[model samples]
Every structure is written in C-alpha cells, then in structure tokens.
Target: MRILLTGSVVATCAFMLFTSGRTLAHDYKLGPLAINHPWSRATPGGSKTGSGYLRVANTGAEPDRLTGGSSPLAERITVHASSTDNEVARMRPVVGGLGLTPGQTVELKPGGAYHLMFEGLRAPLKANDKVPATLTFEKAGSVEVVFDVAAMGAGEGAAKHDGMAPGMHQNGPFQ
Candidate 1:
C-alpha cells in the first residue's frame, strides 16, 4: 500500500511539472541570457506573414549576436530592422546578426525596431496560439522558444493603432 501511494504521488508531481512548464512557455533562460515574454501578434486572415517580439537580457561579461531562427510554422525566418527615411518606412534584413551587448537588454519590438520576420506562414496565427521557434545565437548557441500569440494589431511596445485598413502599409516590416 505504501508503494502504491508513493507511485501515485510521483505521478501527480510529474503531471504538475508538465503543466507548469507549458504555462511558463513564454519565458526561458540559457547560459547568460534571460529571455522574457516571447510573443507575436495574431495574423489577419489570408496573411502569409507575421512578426515576433521578445526581450533578451545579457548578464554575462561577453556579448553575443542573434544569428538566425527557424520555426515550423514559417518557411523562412529572418531577423530584420526597420527605419524611416523622409517619411518612407523600409525594412531591411539584418545583414549579419542582431548584437547583444554585455549587461544590456535588447528588445525586439514593433514600430521601427528589431524583430523576427516570419515569411510563408503555414497558417494564420490565432489569439492564444503558441508558435514554437528556435533561435541561434553567436555565443549562447541555439534555444527553442515558444511565442505567445496576442490579439490582432497588438503592439509590444508603446505603439498604438486605431484599426487602420489592412494592406495600408501601416505596420510590420514595411510601413
């Protein structure tokens, strides 16, 4: 009877651990990096592209670079940065990689900043959906992360949108 009780307790503990891991899927840590709140906005219907945002904090003495990433949901994933020139917004693929300085925090967010550009999405990302991605770094190597799907038009930073028409070139890599 004691042995059976011990086995049941072990099973319950294992189940709790599994569920808790899923509940905290948005946060992760590896090496000297602490990744927080990896998330993405819900894609509109018929949209084949989406973007991901996250905050990476470097606590080590050495710097690192975010080389690339991959996701099963997208055919290609690339890191990109956005800029505006004379009221014209343009996005270019980050040539080498996004740099993370030692003791500094880097935020991949919307509205003219660093973000992950996901092209050829297999399906539209819905609210509350979780997208799994693998990020490759220069020093810290590769880590698999889950991106929490937010509502459509959700901005990670302080940017605000008032329901602008779709394809208006308002947000995203191209604006």
Candidate 2:
C-alpha cells in the first residue's frame, strides 16, 4: 500500500509539471511586466520580412520601455509603428523604443500600431511555427519569449491588411 501511494504521488507531480510547462510556454513574466500571446502572422513565399505582436502589461509603479530584441529566425529585430496621413500609409522604427506607462497595457497588434519588424528572415514563418525572441526592456531588462505563428494576415479586431501595400518600401532600413 505504501509503495502504491508513493507511485501515485510521483505520477501526479509529473503530470502537473508537464501541464505547467505547456501553460508557461505561451506567456512570459519578467519583474512587473507580463507578456501575453506573443504571436506573428505566417509570411508568404519569397517574403524576406515578417512582423510580431504581443501585449505587455506593466503592474509596477514605475514605467518601462521596450527597447529592442533579437531572434534566431531573423537577422535583426526592431520595434516599428505604422501610421497613415492623407490616405498614404507609412511605417517607421520606434525611435528610442516604445514607452510603457505604469499600470498601462501596451499592445503590439497588426495594422497601424506598434509591432516588431523582423528583417532578413531565415525562412518563411509558417502557421503554427513558434518563433523564439528576446525582448529588452528599459527596467525589466531582457526576457525570452516564444511567438506563436498565426494564420497569415491575422490582427486585432477586423482582419484587414492595412498599411501593407504591395511593394511599399516604407519599412525603414529593412526595405
């Protein structure tokens, strides 16, 4: 009876460990920041660039800035924002990084918003593939997270492909 009880306890513990690890794979926490659902869209063939999005919530009293990051799947990763003026869309790198206010939640989504620009992709990011990335923050330092690859052209709210004009060379140095 004693041996059976011990074996059951070990099995329970192992099960919990496996499930917890899977849960943590999609979300990451660093200091006062909680990063949720770091994800990207699958790129088409012959595309050398891709984008990533996520939500960062700052729970601390102080603010932080998302400076930059790196990924093994890309040559370089930089923070970027898209905007439109007079019906013309444009994209530019977020100079000095993106600011995260205290108690505020910043979301990097598709379309005209703050997102990650991955230049020189090693290969096309396919749907369901996980892209590992390291995000550097002003206060939180660096935290590694995996970005889940969603279907191509996925975004927040309506799934319209905004600001991504065909052959638009507005993505700063990446173009």
Best by lDDT: 2
Candidate 1's residue-wise lDDT over 17-121, tens digit each? 665554355456789987766788999988998998887888889999987788999987788998999999899899889998988887788884788888899
RMSD of each: 11.1, 11.1
Q: How many Å off is the CA of 100 in candidate 1?
A: 0.7
Query: Clashing pairs in model 1?
Result: none
Q: How high is the lDDT of residue 73 in model 2?
A: 94
lDDT of 2 by residue, 78-107 (tens): 899999989998899999899998888877
TM-scores for all candidates: the values are 0.74, 0.75
**How high a TM-score does candidate 2 get?**
0.75
For model 2, the superposed segments whose C-alpha errors exceed 4 Å read 1-23, 157-175
Global fold similarity of model 1 (TM-score):
0.74
